[model samples]
Target: MSGSRKYVRHLSTLVTFSVATLVVAACAPTSAPSGAVAQNNHTDSVLTVGLPGSLSTLDVAHEAGILNYYVAQVSSEGLLGVDTEGKIVPALAEKWKTTDGRTWVFTLREGAKFQDGTQVTTDDVLFSLDIARDPERSPSTAVYWAEGTQVEKTGEREITITLPEPSVNFDWTVTASGGLWITSRAFYEAAQSYGSSSDLIMGTGPYRAVEFQADSHATFERVDTWWGKTNEKAPKKIEFDFFSDESTRLLAQQSGKLDISLQIPASQQPQYEALSNTQVTTVTDRSYVGLTFDTAVAPFDDIHVRRAIAYAVDRNSIVSSVLNGKGEVATSIESPEQLGSHIGVESARSLIAQNLADIQTASFDMEAARAELAQSVVPQGFSAELLYPTSIPELGTAALAIAENLKSLGIELTVTGKPVEQWITTLGTGEYGLSYMSYTPTTGDPAEITGWLLGESNPARYSQSDVRQLITEQAGEVDDAARATKILEATKIALNDVIYSPIWWGKNTTAFASRVLHPEINSYFFMSGWASQIGLTDSQN
Candidate 1:
């Protein structure tokens, strides 16, 4: 490891679904208002974003908090883009390359200035990586970056990172941000006693914090000196109104008090679409509900037991009811949405047509499932425990259906539910037998899944060496088409091993008023947060 990076203690590993939405929104700007509306103390220009959760902090080094996702626009800058269409475009660094198989170099653009008017340099990049790689740092994405990866300030205009391996999908890890984007060293040093309650944030993006009320709400003003310039009608200001209830957010929207609402309750999505002033655009990044078993434990230790559980779940019903038939029932982690370069269908043979053939009409095949369960190593009868996060509605509904379906298979089930935080904590700390989890695609990168699935340090703890090797091979293959093929094959191997029973992915939908334009939407984050290039049109959801 070099100065740019460090080996932190084992990361409580793995990035989850919300981290995806939080990242890009962080890169955009939170501002006061710009243009025509600025003439008024309150302009039509204020883009008031409402989120269901609370913002914990504006600092990226800390929690990749959902609320911070709203204010990230005012906090950070220069990200490697994973655009809305699943394309990896440039956001901060103009161009970058790799060397020595393990070392990667990024060339910073010359004129790019921080929000403070100081030009960006290798030091800023090194410090940012240091934040991510620090054990004391509160990075939500510590797991992926908490390895033998190192970063160095090679030159004024460039930085380099040397990983332990060739890491073919290394760029994808950059996309799997745990909120370690660049921050000013001066501001960071000033905010001492770095605790959960600390009031400290310094980002190099388009906006600066004029007021941070914490939890309840906060406000930001545009930096007139931001380096990147967008043609969009950038807002002069941005405000986030935090509410625990979606009704409060909806009320804000109805009263013409809000310009953008990142989320509209599922039931309200249809109504939002009907409103002439709002527009709804659907974006899908893989968000599948899965049943993961602790293979290190009994029965589930048996492949037969895992397969039986897979057969017991009625995924088709989940697709129709929960997902509104918008997403297909997925059997494998390798989604078709991943760019072919990262996930090739050819290598995923066993996981595809053949493995999925029986699942196309997946149902509660109680009799067959029972027979399979009966063959497990359990002596008399086997009882299965199902754990799920209460915050995720789909998990509860899916768990109930599964409990009922699994009962038909003669396997008694104990469904345990906990709030998202407790449930995730329990997962990493070991408090459940089987759990419901979701994954946010780091990009369209299929190879990205390899790390989560097979990495030795995976919180999921899927310790299959063959699966690990296959994924490792896929990532290191330099040839584009060949890499895709290896990725597909690796996916097939993992699925054949039944790491988890996949359900349905959520269709990402961003609802905004007609006046809110150029959201900078992508699989990762909303680009609208960056005040520089964003333009607001009289647009709707």
Candidate 2:
């Protein structure tokens, strides 16, 4: 993945909050009773969903936002797919294996056909991979395919891929999360604009796009000829209505106008939970929200200054007061869910805890912060500005809290909110001293974010030879435990440097009507044809 833009596009709208008072009023709800279901006694064959943001395009290649992936996955699929548990599973490819980490062999699923009734040829897979790896066509995903990598068809139903170097987690590159969506060569070549409303793309998934109006709505229908087994009781039609405003989505859901609402803000969780016909599900998604410093710049360039800011911010209070206790205070750059991809969740947590036990983290100590600042190049505190995305108001709230804390150390921290697009550009161009950083992993590999944060091309412009060396060693380390240890080692160094101050790992909220029954819901649920996995509840049926 491109260190600058790949993961940035997946920044979710799940944590929007305007004020701390609102969060306090919307206290966390008690656990729901077992077997609880929505009580809206309505039967409908269409599943209408409201998305918090508008889709600019259905083109996964050109615009691969999280929402775009959710819609595109309905009809398009990659060689691999991520299950609800965040494990890689077979999609276009029925099975795959590799004798050496560099070379992989895959067997295509037999008799799989696209929605157009044409067989999913090996040529289609090869073409899709080519597009995915082409820098011009897919700049965000091209990094997954190293230079000099090769792909060829070995048989009618088999293909082989050879990477320039060994990669233990290369399989993640072929999954939807990695941005490789397969489409027939003929269809792509014939279309004037692939994935456009007039020429929407096609794939072998359970549903086919029937209509799409940019920034308005997109409609899809179930494909009876789908090769994979689908829920017989699943809705016949899925309609996605875009609502850029969060309140509109809540209103739509409350008015019985929507069956599902994606990206429900954490502040509104209590309101959604109060709905008798709705169920609100929140999961700790694979996302990291933090404070990032341009280490190459002055003041922040001083490790003592960086460490002081880290110690000043109260992460626990931010998560509870500003985030409504929906998220957990982050301990490292990578989320526990991302690290747990190799080891179990508990094991990942234990590994992080064990490694960070001796290391000093920014634990909200004003006295420690002042002492560190006193030892910096500027013994007296300095002024700096922190940029946050205006769309996510909670980030602004967190920034204000941090700024207030910094005041105790004689630091004047200015908090400013910018449009998300401009904020991203400012961060990328190194135009700001301090900024709020958010990232959602594009791949399940634990090394994904770590490599970006510590590697040579890290956005922070901070580099350490030891950390870079460990990152390189872990990329090709086939042993899961060993690779994890290497990553943890790198994480320890980064934390010690305080280039990035960990804030909170985010939680994603989704509201489902009582009539809908989903098999599973998690960070990875939208990576595949999730709509096909949902059906009407037994009571509604």
Candidate 3:
């Protein structure tokens, strides 16, 4: 989430949400399928994943961002990968040795071959890194390398990266989903094109870019001569069908056309499940959905006001209707699944136990919310336009619900929905007072959500300096135990600050035809993370 500094700590947090377990029991384990016809033969088969947003471009290097993550993976390899359990795994690099907190030596796997048949060399690693660490070439979120960076090939299989200051998350940072990627030093420098067209995108991964159609679609094909066989679940081919509307996407899934789609109409889960040849894969994720108040402004600067709006707002109905009871409504950014081991399944159990009575859950109490609203300077009938991004239907409902809730609290709120691009531009410029959005921590590490989302200088203009300092100290700590303690401590401190009314933690939802694979069931929909680990049954068609 930090704009600067790449890489994330290989984190391992326990999750106890029963959503995955329940979905599997309801859908799979049936005696079904016959041969490759009944069972899915992912081997050499083409699999396509759907994207809700439009793809801006295929220029992986210059247009690197989350919306472009799936595209980047087709052409590059990260030094490391964050596994399903949040543990860091070796990818392009075999392993790394940390001399101090500032320097790292990575040992590459010998004979690692690129798509072009060139053996991966230390120079290639260095060359690719030099680009990522360079502002002129890399699209890395952080520009920290401008401070002081020493990158060199120390040996045939060894590379060293030295930083000026301690970047506790540096080792993991370089491998942030879009940060670490391998490019041939020779081809990288000589190549005039980036990922603009399929011809320009190349990588050592099992699949390589073959077709790119801008916003319409993109296709990938298996590298028959790929070097790694360990990735058994890797698809032989992948095609992404882009659709801005949720209805068309869901229709594609029902028609047995799309192999998988992330946007399953929450209300249509049952209809899809009833299909004899359909399997819906749902997972638990470290995603959050909450109301962000402009803490930097007055009226909302008071924690009581934030709490009043939260208490008045009924999140349960929204969860049941909008999320189809598939999500865990968040009482805070940190959900029970993320902290379930430490306590129970309540959203704010670890953060605000003593203040539980004051903070409302998904359920709303109009009376209590109104009393707090009276304390505010809101004129007898103060009303403001609540901005909602029309790109996401959930935000629209959220805006509507929020507006209705505030009215009960004596603060009339008008809901106005707009496209994401317009909403972002207006929100950033402070034209919109309040809006709805989701938070997905780049790193599943607890500090990620708490540190960035609640910190001051947040694009939302919510600044709490005291909370921000705690986040910094915790992030800077190198020790494992100390970092954990600091993270939890910070969580408690920030949530109790009541800067914003935490609503619900977002859920990772996806619909797969019953005949497809149920790979790794988890809350990370975007990653569908364990797709490679999944063994699919044959498609009924």
The residue ranges of model 2 lying beyond 4 angstroms of the native Cα positions read 1-10, 13-43, 190-193, 297-299, 371-391, 407-427, 537-541
Q: Rank the candidates by lDDT, best first.
A: 2, 1, 3
lDDT of 3 by residue, 1-541 (tens): 3111110100101000010001111113333233222233333255667765544455434443344554455445667655544445667777786755678788777777877778877777777777766656753233324247788888878888887655566654555353456777776666575565534565666666677776678887667545444243445666777777877776676565666765454566677666555566556555566666666665766656766776776778788777777676666556556544223345335344543434342347777666666776663436667665443567667667777767765677778765332343343245555545454444444454555554533445655566666666755676644655555565555556655566666555566644445434554323322333333344221
| Winning candidate number (lDDT) | 2
TM-score of every candidate relative to the true structure: 0.80, 0.85, 0.77
Ranking by TM-score: 2, 1, 3
Instruction: Report the number of the highest-TM-score candidate.
Output: 2
- Candidate 1 vs candidate 2: the lDDT winner is 2
What lDDT score goes with residue 237 in model 2? 78
- Lowest summed lDDT across 10 adjacent residues in model 2 is found at 15-24
CA lDDT scores, all candidates in order: 0.55, 0.73, 0.54
Candidate 2 vs candidate 3: the TM-score winner is 2
Candidate 1 residues 290-347, lDDT tens each? 6666677676778777777877888788778765665667656545554343444354
Q: How many angstroms is residue 278 displaced in model 1 relative to the true structure, after the best TM-score fit?
A: 1.7
